[model samples]
Target: MLWPREAGKFIASKARDVKINMEGVRKVAKVIADAVQEGKMDVKEFKQNEVLPINKGLTTAQLADWMFLINTLNFNFWTPDGVPKFSIEYEGKIHTGYLAMVACVNRAIDEGKKMYDPHYYSKLTLDDIKHIFRSDTPSTMPLFDERVRVMGEVGTKLIEKFDGSFINILKQVSGSAMKLVELVISEFPCFCDVAEYEGQKVAIFKRVQILAADLWMLFHGEGLANFTDIDQLTMFADYRVPQAMAYFGALEYSDSLHQRMVKEELFKSGDREEVEIRGCSIHGTELIVEETKHVMAERGMDVVGINSISVDYFLWDYRLNNAKELEKIPYHRVRCIFY
Candidate 1:
């Protein structure tokens, strides 16, 4: 929640003060410009002195922050401190860029510096890394053949550097939801599926292709939105996405749970169909029916076909307070009942 509005105003003001130190930057730029005017800098000298780090188009506050962070990696990174406000790689690279800038300056101070061509340098991408690593030393096989399929989350920038379709498969959603499951099979890791028997649950999932983690989360959530219908489940079962490291969360079932899913009732009277539970029960709670089918068959349902939706899944919550904390998912009831 926002803290009384005034707190937000104060924070914004404090941030603005540190954003741009205009005066300090003018002093630095003038010193470099003066040296150039005196002919103390050659074309090569000017390149390092003016073009390299100094000409990278960084703002004054950015340059100052970079200087301060490299000197001492401490600054406002988060609000009220829970998770660190900075990414580890980003934070580490901050220091690396700072050191590089300092080294460039030192180089400019000596040997009159050297020339720089913007066209000569570019950021490396994953494909470049693959190519570089493969060609770096003599190798009989390409790097792609030598290593595991995934080399961590290679940056999209790196993928672009190499100019290949390594990431094309993941570019968009598949034509059908089933196609997505197939793609997941071909691409990502699957945590759980019907293929390998997992002790987590005894029953088979209707969907063949799915990310185990996704199914796990969906089942635990017990919501119709996540679980989907049989048609959608068919999509997930077709191919294999690699299994992930862990199940989505802790959820379990008794083999006997599916046992309660027997046909409830079946009745046919003239033009209509009726299904009665016969003597079905839910937690020992009996069904209350006023009229018996023996008297008037049309008025009462003697039996009905059991449905996938009728099979209710339950989670045990011993404590009352946390019981409502959990969500209840209705199984294949509504449409599944008639189908």
Candidate 2:
């Protein structure tokens, strides 16, 4: 199987002949240097407390279920026309897009539904899912039917194969991150994120990899989430991270590609430009991880446990916090479940 780390190295080596800019990478490294010097970038920054639900007191099984459900349905939520995004008011605050989806799931759990249970979700109807994910505002989620279908599919698969628990699958992986990813893609069709480049098969597996990373984060690298090769997982190559990378000068697109993105042109999942953007972003984030470690070493700081997953979280959170500034750059628009 083509794992994410191996795919990053392979696609990046192949992409050097493409029109991606290395000068931009150098500029991003400088930014990383400043962030490290300012003591803003560190693996410890990606704590679960930084997320929502201040005092839910979730168990290990519930947390695993939450991660599995959310990551299975996580995908495109970009609203180019400035419409109100799919949002939910949860815990007295409004969350839009991906966070909103997570909030809704949490809301279901709060309303006395065993939503974390695959057996419960497997029997869910289309309207049940629609109501569960219903937006607070006028804007509804895009690909609503597809999302509903995927929820039922994944839930049923879990019940039939994994004994109605996502934790069972994790236990079967034997503490290997790559094995977990392979298991997810092989068993769950929605998690199969792959592309072909130059007669070579490349595996991005964005959602599956993020699920693994979230497991590691949620468990603090202990229990069922303690994967020995967690560091081997690369960054989740989605649209937002690439935009952040472009803003930080770690990724540059051709003028034609840039214009298309600015105009909100839709690229299919495996289009050449889309693949290049996602692949380059993964490789660029790998570089950022290395550069941040080097800078930490130079500053006489400890760099023992720094990895690509933490770097990805940092970049993703950076993009969210700096949305206004990063919006100045156009993000590639690809409507696919794989992201």
Candidate 3:
């Protein structure tokens, strides 16, 4: 089995439906490199991005457990076409997509629910989820049953094996992000976000990596959250990031595939086209990071905290900020718990 980085390159090499444009990769990288050199983009920006929930009065351990629970149910927030996106109203602002998911959790907490505690959520039922995650809009969160099941699975495991706190699991990593990622995948079967393509097992592990990234950002890389190998995490291969790459011209789909995507045709989780798009997105991001480093080197500027996760955060935020400009590009859709 190939892990995400190697699997990405291998799948991109053999891809038939998706292609990576090296020139476009360098093009975006140059833009990002300039931002980094000018101090416009870095880890600080990631932590302070408006999309993230405010962290004023929350404790680190509470924040850690919240992130763990959120990432567990983070998959499949994309709504069907023409639906008002699953949204939530909080603090006089409306949030959609991933932000809405985060808001719903915070709202539940404010309503006196111990949402961050595994013991509380592990016993929740389907009706409980519907009420807690009740949308401000007409559209409900997708995969509701699966979300409840995943919550129970991970929450129960934490109670039984990790002393009822995700912080215990983090303690076992000893400041290694990769080990934490591995432990998350090994200990919780719901987090094993892997698939098979052309007779080889490929691990995308999107939510697991995002879990680590969220924890690291939440703690500002201090205390139990410091991870030496945090850079090993690749860009999460999701629908939106690929759209950003395509908008920048870094990723290109075949005419057939592009037409299918434009038509909003849903692909199964492990379809060849889906795998190629996701894998190529990962490899394409690695190229972007490399080119950014090269450009930074040429300018003699040592941009601190330049890595795949940081770049991923930048690109993801770029997509959110430029959603209007990127609507021309179609994103591949796969309604699975893995992405």
Candidate 4:
């Protein structure tokens, strides 16, 4: 039987089936790079030592080229380890602590698919990218056929789910239907100079702060990140890991950060169907599951709590049993399966 953590592994949601492949992205990059190499493009603008990718309108092709030139990558939220992490000059002091895992996955259309998986490891590999644009594109691909028909009825359902957002983009990219409705949203802005299909210039690099805020909010709402007094999310309810987390950054491994989030969900709450932490905020640190917040609070720590997949455990305990947190968070993520 598949538990929530186990269930997450089963999630591909046809994400693998839809969207433009990495090879296509790579090809686009190569085309731009070739232009730059032949002096057909201006080096003064695109070069990393002098400028940022934002100015060039970093066209879709240029974005792929950036993968090779710059240390940053979209879709995969990875930061170099052991570097000055995230150092911003605050109050004239360079305060650097844990670097925020800066990663982006472009979920373009919003078909209301379940974006978070409770259990997922492994990264999307180069092979996965190659497969996306291979000759054998799927049947429902908008590229192959004007009509997008996936999973039998899903394509139709998706059409009604917000039909217009992705149709043309998929047609431009390939005949394939997007795995989910949103197609490459986060990844695109990093590379392309999206001017509102037409507005003023606000590239993703220039708007990292905005991007971060969006992600932080989404992760918190999803059951990936949380403030809890129970196990983060054990296989069992009300008996799991302590702390809150919807997902963690898997940028080091794959194109999509969503997958890592799934596994992180398990890690945060999978121990003994109780408190299970994949590792810890500290890599070498380890803990036992049965440990309870009550036990920790006796030592004057109210921060500890088991993670429950449900809010029945959270709302009751989070405000009362835990910190004197006054911030009002009303809605909660309702977990349900997605096609």
lDDT of 1 by residue, 163-266 (tens): 32212322333223344445433442221122111112111221222222222222232322133332223111110000000010111112232132222122
Order the candidate numbers by TM-score, best to worst. Answer: 3, 2, 4, 1
Among these predicted structures, which one has the highest TM-score? 3
For lDDT, the strongest prediction is 3
RMSD per prediction, one decimal? Answer: 29.5, 2.2, 1.6, 22.8
lDDT of 3 by residue, 1-339 (tens): 899999999999999999999988998899898888777786766522444545545666677888899899888888777878899888787878887887888888888898889999989999999999999889988888998899999999999998888899889999998999899999989889888988999999998998998889877888999898888988888898899999999999999999999999999998999999999999999999988998999999885677878878888888887878988899999889987
lDDT of 3: 0.87
Instruction: Point out where model 2 deviates above 4 Å.
Output: 16-20, 33-39, 42-54
Off by over 4 Å in 1: 1-167, 170-174, 190-231, 234-339
> Model 2 reaches what TM-score against the true structure?
0.92
When summed lDDT is taken over every stretch of 10 residues in candidate 3, the lowest stretch is 47-56
Error of 4 at 309 (Å): 9.8
Q: lDDT of each structure?
A: 0.22, 0.79, 0.87, 0.23
Q: How close is candidate 1 to the true structure, as a TM-score?
A: 0.19
Clashes per candidate, residues 3 or more apart or on different chains = 27, 0, 0, 42
